[model samples]
Target: MALWGGRFSETPADAVFALSRSVHFDWRLAPYDLRSSLAHLAVLQSSGLLEDSVAEPIRGALNELISEVAAGRFVANETDEDVHSALERGLTEKLGAIGGSLRAGRSRNDQVATDLRLYAIDHMIEVAQQILALQSALIAKASEYGDAPAPGFTHLQHAQPVLFGHEIAKHVQGFSRDLDRIHDWLDRALVSPLGSGALAGSSLPLSPEVTAKNLGFTSSAANSIDGVSDRDFVAEALFTLSMVGIHLSRIGEEWCIWATTEFGWAKVADAYSTGSSIMPQKKNPDMAELARGKAGRLVGNLTGVLTMLKGLPFAYNRDLQEDKEPLFDSIDTVLLVLPAVTGMVATTDFDREKMALAAPLGFSLATEIADYLVQAKVPFAHAHEAAGKCVAMCEASGRQLHQLTDEEFASIHPSLKGDVRDVLTVHGALESRTTVGGTSPSSFKQQIKESTAITAAYSKEFTDKAKAFSEMMGA
Candidate 1:
C-alpha cells in the first residue's frame, strides 16, 4: 500500500507510477534523506512528540537502514514511489507500529528540500576540490613557463608580446573567481528547510535550529512556505557550474589552438590525445574538444532548471520534482570533465621556442615603438601615427620591424633612429612594460608568487571546510 493511500480507493496507474517514481535518479539522495530523518528524530524526541522509548527503537531502525544502504544490501523497489516512501516502508517493516511515528512531524516536501540541500553542499565541496586541482595545474604551468614570451591577441590577431606565464595567469584568475562564487553561493544554500513541514510550520513544536545545526547548516529557513519552495540554491549552483564550464571552455579553446600545427605553441601528451582513424600521422585533442563541447550541456542544464522553476507557485508543487535531475546532471557533468581537463593541462608540453619565435612576428613591437615616441615628448596621437608608418613601410618592403633600415626608421619619425632597435626584440618589448601586473620578468615573478599564495589560502579554506563537513556527517 502507498503511504498516502488511506484517503483514496485506488492506487496510481502503472504509467503514472512510472512517471512519478524518482528512485532511478534520486537514489543518490538516500544517505542524505536518512541523515535528515535522524536529525528530525532528535527534534521530535526533545519536543515530546515522540517518547524516548519509541524514539530509541526508531533510531535503531534508521541506523540499521543506513547500514543496509552503506552495504548496498538495500535499494528502492518498483512499488516505492520515492526515496522517502522507500525508507518509510523499510522503517515500518523493521519496527512495526513505532516506525510509522517517525513521520508525525515531517513531510516528504521538507524532507526532499533538506536532502537536496545536504547533497548539494557535499557535492559542492567535491566540485571545489576538483576545481582546486585544476587551479594547481594552471599555477604549475605558469611557474614552469615564467617570463617566456608568447603572442597575445585581440580579435584573433597578434596585438602584443606577453609572458606565456601571464597568459596562463589570466585563466587562473578566472577560476579563482569561480571558486569565490561557489563559496558565496554555498552560504545561501546552507539554510535548512527541515522544519517547514509540507507548506506550513509544523504544530509539533520541533526545533529547526537543532536539525539545521546537526545537519551542518548554520541557520534555518525563516519562512515555512518559502523554505519548501525555494530552489534558488540549485539555480545558483547550476550558474556557478555553468561559469566553470565557460572558464574551462575558454582554456579548452586555447588548448585546441595551441596544439594545432599552425600555432605550434603547445603539444598535448599522447596520453591525452587521440589517433585519427585512417590517418596514421594525425593526433587530435579529443580531451580538449570534449571539454569545450560539454560546456554547452552544462549551460543547457542551467537553463532547463530555471525554466522548471519559473512558473511554480510559492509553496512546494509537483513541478519541484523537475529540479533534481538538472541539478544532478550539472554536478555529474562537471565532476566528469574537470579532472580530464586538468590532466590535459598538467601534462601538455609547451614549445617555448616556437612561442618566442612567433611572439615578435606581425609587428607586435609596434606598441612599444609608440610608447618609445611617447617617452621622447611626442604626443601619443602623433606617436601612434609614427608607429603605423613604420608598420606600413615594413609591410611594403616585405620585411619585419626589426629588419627596417635606420633611414627607413628615421623617415617615420626623427626619434626613430637606429636606437629604435632597442625596443624591437621580444625581450625588449616585454621588459619595457614594467608596471605592476605587466609581462616583465620581475612583474611576472611577483604574479606567480601572489597566485601561489592565493591558491594556498583557498586550498586551506577548502580543507578546513571539508573537515568541518566531514565531522558533521560523522564520517
Candidate 2:
C-alpha cells in the first residue's frame, strides 16, 4: 500500500512507482528500520498518542517482523515501494488499523534520515575494526622483519637506506589517522533525527529523548530542518573511507612494484597471486592491482554524492535518496578490500637480500657521506657540494661509492682522509639513523611496541562502543 493516497483520486502511474522504488537497494536497512519502529512505538505510547493496547501488539509484531526479516522469510515484494513502505505494509497486515497509528508524529523524511544514520554508524564501526585488523597484520609483519634493510625512494628513485619494517609501519600511521576520522565522524552521527517530522517537528508531546536513547543516539536533533536535510555524516564517511582506499592503493602500488621480476624484492603467496589468462608464466598481483584501482571508485562515489547534495535547498529532497548507493558501495568496497589486502601482506614473503642489494644504488648513501663531513666541522654548504662532486666523480668512473679508494677520498676533501669508508655499508647507513621514528633497529622495535599498544587501545574503544550499542538497542 502507498503511504499517501487519500488526497489522490487515482493510483500512481507504474512508471512513477518504478522510478521511485528504493526497496531494491534499501532493504538492507530493514533491521534498522524495524528497530527504529520499536523505539517510535515507545514514544507513541508514552505520549498518550497510542494506547498500551495498541502499542503492545505493534511492538510484538515489530519484533517478530525483525526476526522474520533476519531469517529471510519476510522480504520486500515487487509491490513494495521502499523499505519504509514495505515495513509499514507488513505491520498493517498484522494489526489492521493499529499498525497505521505508529505514523502519528513521524514522516518518511525523519524515518529515513534516522535509518541511514543507524545503518551508517553500525557499518562505520565495523569498517574501523577491519582497519585495525589490517594494522595488526602490518605490525606483525614489521616485527617479523626487524631492521631488514631496503632502499627508500624519493621520486621513485633510490634516495636512502631504510629498514623494510619501517616502510611497512608507515602505512599504519595513515590508517591510524583514518581511525581518528571515523571517531570524529561518530560525534555528529550519534544524533537522532527521528522526531524531526518532515521539516518542522511535530506539535504532539512525543518524547524524542526516549526514542533517541532507545535507538542508541546520544541526543535528538535540535533544529528540525537541519535534522532532516543534513548529510555531512555521509560525506565525511565517504571522505574517510576514501582516505583508507588511497592508503590501501599505496600499499598495492608498492607491492605490485616489489613483486616484479626485475625487482623481486617481495613475493605474493600462490593463493593471493593469479595466473594470467594467456601467459603460462604469469602469477599476477591481481589483488593488489584491484586494490590500486578501487581508490578511484571510492573517490568517484564520494564525489557523486557530494554533487548530488550541493544543489539541494535545506529540508528533505528526493535527491537525498542518491546518497545511499554510494555510501553503501564504499562501505562494501572497503570491507572487501581490507581482508584480502591484509592476507596478501601477512602471507607474502620478502627477499631481504634483494632489497639490501638495491639499498646503496643511485648513491643512496650520499647523505651519509655529507653528514659524516659535517661531523668533522666542515661547513654544510661545502659538504653538500663535496658530496655532489663525489656523485659526479662516481658517475664519470662508473663505480659505486664504496669502490672509491682512501687516496681518492682524501683528494676530494680533508675530512675524507681517515676511515671514511666506515659509513659506506648498507648496515652502517641503516644504523646511523638513530633518532626517534628513524630506520635504526632500536627505533623500528620501539615503533612496533607503540603500534601494538595503539592497535590494542583502538580495538578496546571499538569493543566498548559495540557493547554500549548492544545495550542501548536491547540486543
lDDT per residue for candidate 1 within 1-475, as digits (tens), equals 3678888788888998899888888888999988888999999999898889999999988888888998998998878888888888899888887788988878888989999999999999889999999999999998888768999999999989999988888888888998999889888999999999997988889999989999999999999999999999999999999999999899889999999989888889999999977999999999999999989999999999899889896799998898999989989999999999999999999998899888988888999889989889999999999999999988999998888988988887898878888888888878877898888889888887888898898899888888888777653
| TM values, all candidates | 0.97, 0.98
- Stretches > 4 Å off in candidate 2: none
lDDT of 2 at 96: 90
Overall local distance difference test of candidate 2? 0.91
What is the per-residue lDDT of model 2 for residues 1-475, given as tens digits with 9 covering 90 to 100? 8898889999889999889999999999999999899899888888888888888999999988988999998999999999999999899989898889889999999999999999899899999899999999999888777858889998999999999999999999999999999999999899999999999999999888878988989999999999999999999999999999999999999999999998998889998999977999999998999999999999999999999999798799999999999999999999999999999999989998888788889999998889899999999998998888889889999998878888788888878855777888888988888898999998888888898998999999998887777665555
lDDT at 17, model 1: 89
Candidate 1 segments whose C-alpha is farther than 4 A from its true place:
none
Would you list the clashing residue pairs of candidate 2?
Answer: none
